[model samples]
Target: MPNRLRRAVAGLIAAVLLTASATTATTANAAPSSGFDNWSCKPSAAHPNPLVLLHGLGGNGPGNYSFLGPFLAAKGYCAFTLAYGQATPAIPVGGTVSIAQSSAEIQAFVQQVRQATGAAKVDIVGHSEGGFQSIYGPKVRGYAGQVGKVVALAPPTHGTEFGGLVSVGDYLGLRPLVDQVLQQFGCPACDELIVGGAAVAKLTTGPIAQPGVAYTVIASRFDALVTPHETSFIREPGVTNKYVQDTCPLDPVGHVGLAFDPTVAQLVANALDPAHASRVVCAFGPPL
Candidate 1:
């Protein structure tokens, strides 16, 4: 009986992970629009805080919210994305940007959105490294209470083994390339999302949560980059955690999929709107 139960549990867990990866295509995270290098747009009453979206390493904000921006605008949310990270002389972005550096960029962008929109706080959504910045970066810089809510789509809250793979790059004589690309971010040796020498762990267990900030983590069990599946969970109190595979049995959102997956996007829209809390099914499994 014990063996049978163990096997069943493992199988169920495997199924969820498989579902997570099947959520969407693994090509590259893309946005619906383009062209925002040193440009600015103002926000109106219907769309407040000038929604800020942060992309991961080597990413441009334009491609970050391709499908999402239009959908959000339709739903009355003023949307915006920013490009960050060290740019190479010949390389175009929408690529890799260090986590710590991008976090600061998020803070500055939030300030800009606030100044433009006249809102005290704004909504922040991040992908990959942007996820860390939205959730933990600003608060670490002493701006915790200023954020109204943080929504992370498949954020590596607990970090990942695949990321650990990249931490080894600098040690193998690619140090100059690493330093030139990363020095702009001023990343310290212990930055978790950077070198993987405890940046993720230190950040995770250190203080992933802050008071007065509404937190929600949207994750997929099929994430190829962040594994063990559960790492995407935000374990802090008062945080509303959502697992797409469990919520929508047919949702085809993996790690990158969650960014544009319509179902997941619908869920994201609901979370951003506090009045519609009942629209979300917060149970562990689909209702019987």
Candidate 2:
């Protein structure tokens, strides 16, 4: 199946899982469950900077981050997630808009989080396309000095092959058709993920990481979405690039699983606060 269809299928799965696993308390305040979207919460000394969660393509804030929000809050960190790239609110999928537009949304959200928490800066934790926003928003576009650290989970920093389908499409001269079909899903970001797409060409041509902002990319060798896997790796001098398999050899987590994996969550915690990093345990389970 094409990547577009696969994404639609993923959206269905997210909807089902969201409904099945929801608690009454969280469901009652579904807009911002698990300490997310809470304007009243202030940043604590132990966690001076608030953490923002960016979801992947075809994923909304609550659906993508229901697990990570509470996880970070338990660590005394103020976490927040917002819905962006929504060309159709009736459809409800997020991160479907162009990267440039999404970057603007991130900028606005970062400011809002900063004003609400009374913090000078915010740390970003993004998954998939969200990872791109975490970097582009702070480094290239908005949020300039307001961003401190960024942790990208299974990000296609360079680009992907649609799980090797891009090569097939290119060989058959179906690249444009494929891109068009994916874009029809109400997500222009999908077109940007194409191998030689304009977005990929532009992002890779410049310095991906900016000065004064710490960067970490946690990728999976087994990730099926980010083809070649190396696309997710950052070769910059100062960036800390981690392979999930290296941290836990038994981990079979794929692209989507990176967000749901508990081990990856622990890794995120470690990245957020390296000074007081927790000892990560090796375990096996579905991202749920």
Candidate 3:
């Protein structure tokens, strides 16, 4: 890679680390985000399925769903979040392990939520890597029947190129070197996310979606990470794919901001319960 491109990649990595650190600090000091990890909350008639919120790479459950958790809870849904793919018991970050391992963790959590709530099926709302697992768990990890619906936000359903950086690396035959660097940094999941990688191939070998499960994918046009943005869409018959700009042209929320954007939250609410669907209210400026 050229010196300039190398510097850019290094800078991006630094930003991710800083963001993770700040998120961890915020989570440690503040009270638990509302509507998460409430074991006593039961599924209601209006919303019979408990919601499972899955975070992205280097994200903890509480920090990722701080906005959406409370948003859904206010709508009378029993919501839950869990941190999976932690490299060690001491690591606060998640989604760093292999994709298959993370899928198993999701499967176990789903089973636990079902048993506790006595609900036959649970809905899933996954952001980024979490979004990938939402489909991977059901299709690849034998979690089909246990899930009712999946609402994926900026999910790299087909995989991403990190704005063509991975593609450039491939052209230069530096893919292996890149993988080694990511592995050294404790993010095997990063390798799996590269376009046409082994993990992505396994996930996309057959149909990406399972039968009897409703699927909705929401992407942001301004997402700088999941480049081309269209990769987030699942080209299946029953799956609904949407861009944030489709409903709100002025909204500029990106990959990380998808979790905090209110419009995205409303879109999630609509997907989880189409029977009570309402118009998505648009907002401006930073995600809140």
Candidate 4:
């Protein structure tokens, strides 16, 4: 099967799993439920702009925020998430969308948030393809001036092997199929996107970060998706890098695991609140 089709199938699986697992955390005893705690949380003077959460491919906006949005909300940041890159609102799985379009969507979404909240800027957290989506507004649409910070999780800041498969598909004249498949997920450059990952290459083809905003990356040692691991990091002038394995040598957290991991969530929260940076202690296991 073509990688595109394989992804469609995977997206279906992810949608089902997400619906089941994502909603379970909202109950009263949900153990802080990571970011889910902050959905309706009021913004304090310390954190003004609402935090936006972007999900990976095959993810709906609510699925992305099940924990993350609420978590930020509870911590005093108004949290919002939207379904981007979806061809049909009914399905809401992202894969077939265009990077440029998603970036534009993010820019517009940010404007909407700022207008609604009358805030200065926002902090963005993105996972997987969303990592790319989160930065699109800042990089492509020139919203870096308006964005406070960006944190990317398992992002393909550089292209990956998954893109090579798309190259093979394009060379064989499957470009149309690739584009159509990508369109379903609201990704326009599927051929170019997974064709060894050209989005980040293009994003960093010039300067990686704008002058005012901060860039932080969280990467796992055993990421099976963005292979070679280094692709997860964006090397530029104003970026901070953290590797989970570097701190927790015994941590076997992989790509997907990091998305759902509490430790990773705490690191993300700490990143959001840098004053508490002292709380981050790399652990060999859960013992820390």
Candidate 5:
């Protein structure tokens, strides 16, 4: 890379890191979302398995699922959330570490949830990075048997170009430099999310959906982060993929808002319990 370009990229990375650090500092102490982490709540007969809610990159368990967690719990499901993949004590936001490490944390949490609820399996509702881990934990991290259903919202199952910045970097052969800079700042997962990065390549090597595990992928056309949005869908035989606009044409929800969107919560409810599925009620607004 040219010296000038290198300097520019370094400045951009530093700005992003500083912004992330500021955001985490502000929201790190936020309380857990309502209706989650209820260790004493057991799975009922209708909802046979407890539900695990996973948050996205740069998000904590409480802030991400503030709406969805309570919605599911009100529907008679035992929903739980955890803050995983904390890259450093200084940054309390989750999903900043490598996917492998985060998936291992998920495995341990799943065991704890199963033991607490006495259920054979648990269902997953993940958003963004959490959505990727929903499948990664089962396919790569050996949590398949413990997971029954997975509902992914706005997940970059394939990968993202970060609004074409990643492609630009790859073309300039600056990806390695970018990755190094991000890792030094304790955000290795940021590089791993780039299109054609090592982690995404590993996920694409084999079938994304595991057998005997029900999968549902929900995306939004308005999502700016996961460009083209269709990359969030799984083209497997049994997996169900949907777009929010398919039902609510003008909902205008974005990537981060998907977890807090009522329309998405309804979609998740139907995915988790198809036997009693109902029509989705759409509303217009940003995330709550």
Candidate 6:
């Protein structure tokens, strides 16, 4: 190879090595410096409401919000996470149970958080399926007053097109096949997320937002899962809707990437405690 080509290859290899090292380090130490899952940590005046994190679509607590947990804790808030909707009674994969079942689990968990922290209410942050659950739980379960704010990232508020599969499925009456495939993957939430599905239809038939809780949705235009992109928006009054590209044009974070995106994490921190909102950084890599 020419001298110039050799130099370019060497530079690229070095960059890749640096990125790999950074990713490893981040994964190893994603937990907060202050520590998490501590039942003893009480809410302070600066962070009065405890933050509950709900993971989305076949995700668990630690796997999904490892970075965000520590990030929020570093910001002076008590953060907690719950695992719900396991696919099979024997298996441990979450986000596979019905949305209602998961929502019920969330209600119980939030109640536990309130009792443990001795706080009147709690703030919630969720991604993908968790996004809608965070709101749906409070609204349907009559716990609206117990939640102060909800921040959803890349949530499918309305059912998704699945790249028009939903439309096609409806036209062809293929609900059973779709449900069967979702079941094979242990994704009960899939049935609910499909366009014109029962759970999705029920959520839309009523109000999407609760009476007192504040709602913020952070989504990406490039999200192929939630097609038309507009479906991610919460249409209820007083909802704060934001598209990542609008705030950071260069950001290409997609649906699942939102949880791992550090910029999106910062946005969650800001939403949780708006009085002391952090600066939104526009860097892209592993969310951590």
Best model per lDDT: 3
In each prediction, how many residue pairs overlap at the backbone (N, C-alpha, C within less than 3 A)?
19, 0, 0, 29, 0, 2
Residue-pair clashes, model 4: 29
lDDT by residue for model 5 over 64-124, one digit each (tens)? 6656776677677778888888755554467777888888899899999999888999999
Q: Please, what is the whole-model Cα lDDT of each candidate in the order they appear?
A: 0.58, 0.72, 0.76, 0.63, 0.75, 0.70
Tell me the tens digit of each residue's lDDT in model 3 across 116-214.
889999999998889988988899888789899999988877889872322212222335544554456656788788898767899889898899999
Error of 6 at 153 (Å): 0.8
| Model 2 regions lying over 4 Å from their true place | 1-34, 163-186, 285-288
Question: Which pairs of residues have clashing backbones in candidate 2?
Answer: none
Candidate 1: Cα lDDT at 167 = 21
Superposition error at 38 for model 4 (Å) = 8.5
Which one wins by TM-score: 3 or 5?
3
Candidate 6 residue pairs that clash: 260-287, 261-287
Better TM-score candidate (1, 3): 3
Tell me the lDDT of candidate 3.
0.76
TM-score of each: 0.69, 0.82, 0.81, 0.75, 0.80, 0.79
125-167: candidate 2 lDDT, tens digit per residue: 9988888777667766745578888999877788888833222
Q: Give the per-residue lDDT digits (tens) of candidate 4, residues 79-173.
A: 67777766655554543467776677777877876776667888889877777666656877777878888888877777666643222123223
Instruction: Arrange candidates, best lDDT first.
Output: 3, 5, 2, 6, 4, 1
lDDT, residue 119, model 4: 72
Poorest lDDT segment (10 consecutive residues) of candidate 3: 163-172
lDDT at 2, model 2 = 73
Q: After aligning candidate 2 to the native by TM-score, how far in Å is the CA of 24 from where it should be?
A: 9.5
Ranking by TM-score: 2, 3, 5, 6, 4, 1
RMSD of 3: 7.1
